[model samples]
Target: MSAIPVKSKIDRDQLLKISPFKEVIKPTVPHKHADYFELILLEQGGGYHVIDDQRYEVLPPTVYFMKPGQTHCWDFSRIPKGYVILFREELLTRECLDVAYNLPVNITLNDVETLPGLTRQFCDDYRAGASPAILKAYLQLIVLKTGEEARTQSAEGRFTPLYYQFRSLVNEHFHQVRKIQAYANMLHIPAAQLNLICKSASGKTPSMLLNERIVLEAKTLLSNTDLSIKEITDVLDFSDPSNFVKFFKLYTSFTPKQYREMAIARLH
Candidate 1:
């Protein structure tokens, strides 16, 4: 008798590009993927979602945004029926990608109680053979609504749309524009005004936010890719490799090599 070869669990891209939507496979136990983002709409299910080392209960009409590189897992023992849309970052429009990727927004969706009629209609459309493009648009709408609702329900209302926009622009262009003045120019606002808006909304200066974004990308590249430090420095538009090293150490307290070693160790 031949032994059965165990297949690895399906990832987000495979689930989206290969699998049929209506076919319900056996429930996936707690699992994580490193390369894909998942936007899930729970039609009917109760579970625990672990994202970025934080755990929350998942209930009906729940919408979640799981970014790449964040560790996420879910337990569906109690309720096992829902809709999961697995998509890659490239699936998003350029504008959506600019907003969603590399920003500091919280990506977990907790027990979302308010389900709008529009979302219900979207779900119905998804079930009724909607195109992937339509599904992506609906998912983006839900994410935007969730953020808006969160801001309205919060006491401080710290995350304004302009703040989000600035943050998105910073994430998308931090490597090229290392100064607040350049960003202000791009956004068509005075540098002082941009600084005031950032300070009012996030309590951080625009320069600080931009540096943080650049440092984050540097760290990601240092850990995930095989690019040399010089190449990385050039890609990030540093005047010199020494200057890039100085900037990286100033932000992270560790040299590039040290940081990369630590990150790889954690994975092992």
Candidate 2:
């Protein structure tokens, strides 16, 4: 717990920070951003990012939207070249209507050349003490562009609303319910239908998505708190710590103790 930096120190007001990925000096440890939105634009990189339950390859020309309370870890093979645009929802002047933006979604921004100019300008303006209005306009532009990209994926995009709802259900109930069928029942759909919905929208089955969400929450607790394994099992409503260990190892390849140690080492 002393090793993983908890997000208890975040300020109350909405905040925004922009920095080049290569210049960041902090450890890229597995952690949760509990109080703000994260917008990361990648131009060049190859690595793995575990966001929530699913794992994503850190491919170039991609933008990832990470909502508040999501846990993410980056293990880039090389120093990634990109911009990390972080902000709180309060920073924006207008409300964004993209339903998918409320959750985490990674969209491929194909025009790689275009992102650099905006990111560089934003950083420059930020460092030179530019007006809040100008800085926010840049943030809005990136969000709008990413939303357009999400919408361009045909019928797949049409399935986003349902997918988001299902995911939200999983996020909210994952601590207490681990069964995919249970989630389907809550969503008022058959288990098989729910699986198909997730597959169509995310290329991953509902079971995998649900498992990942549970694993993420477990990992967060293990890393950020001083609670013992038994206490964590109780928090997650597991039958016992042994059962919890088995489930954690199934997705993470590390038992709770091992995962916590490794994360603490990296963060330290």
lDDT of 1 by residue, 1-268 (tens): 0011122334544524322223332344333444555555565656566554345676655556655444455555465444555556555655555445423323334445444455666767866888877877776665555555444333432545556567767755666767778878878889998888888876788888888767766775665567888888888899999999999999989999998888778656
Estimate candidate 1's RMSD in Å. Answer: 9.3
Q: Tell me the spans in candidate 2 whose CA falls farther than 4 Å from its real position.
A: 1-5, 8-11, 23-27, 93-104, 153-216, 219-229, 237-268
TM-scores of all models? Answer: 0.58, 0.60
Question: Model 1 segments beyond 4 Å from truth?
Answer: 1-38, 41-121, 127-141, 144-157
TM-score of 2: 0.60
Give a tens-digit lDDT track for model 2, residues 103-220. Answer: 3467777676666677878888888988888888888776766766666642343445556668767766777777888888887888898888889877889888888777777877
Q: Output the lDDT of residue 98, model 1.
A: 40
Any residue pairs clashing in model 1, and if so which?
A: none
Cα RMSDs, all models:
9.3, 6.6
Clashing pairs in model 2? Answer: none
